[model samples]
Target: MHELSITQSILDYSLSEAKKHGGVKIREIRLLLGPFSGIVPECIQMYMDLLAEGTIAQGVKIKATTLPLKVRCRDCGKESEITRRHIACPFCESLRLEILSSNDFIIDSLEVDTDGD
Candidate 1:
């Protein structure tokens, strides 16, 4: 579903970056995936397989690293890591918390072949 459009964007960005770096082939893409970002790595790989055909981005391996969920307590203003099941702030025992991480998907880096083929 949403992974389709997101994967397309990833491919587009990868191609753009590869071209900028004078790369002839994109070998791999490193991704930082948030735990609660709702993005499935398998889905993205499937979409990328379809979308990257005939492009320099084809045959690209996606390496996704899941990030931990961290939140800041509104009362104590302290950041702590917590699981998705339990969201309460550990320091102040307050229900009000501001999410600091685990809600975003980011492209970290790319491995590309710069040699002329």
Candidate 2:
């Protein structure tokens, strides 16, 4: 699954950052997942657990926040939140729409235990 690759990348980045900060173990990782990101949180968590096996990140907790889909109507200049099933503009019923958000996948923060306790 693609979640495996995503989890691997997250682990690699987290490990690198933790090393830079002299971290001994990773505790938590917070993520912001957009509605259009197409990544499943459950799969990511499962893959993270498997990938972290026997590593310093073992038992690390992964927390994700889902962002709603927001779109701006080009014709009426109105912004609205729409589900995946509906992407058209509600105000003017126009097909010309600009996606404002809900397409980003970002790692917001990480919590780690440093070596120097």
Model 1 residue 10 distance off true place after TM-score fit, in angstroms: 0.3
TM-score of 2: 0.83
- Model 2 lDDT at residue 90: 77
lDDT per residue (tens digit) for residues 1-117 in model 1: 899999999999999999998999998999998878889898988889889999998889888998878889999999998776777888778988888874578999999999774
Error of 2 at 79 (Å): 3.8
For all the candidates, what are their Cα RMSDs to the real structure? 2.0, 2.1
TM-scores for every candidate against the unseen true structure: 0.88, 0.83
For model 1, which pairs clash?
none
Which structure among the candidates has the greatest lDDT? 1
Please estimate how well model 2 matches the true structure, expressed as its whole-model Cα lDDT.
Answer: 0.87
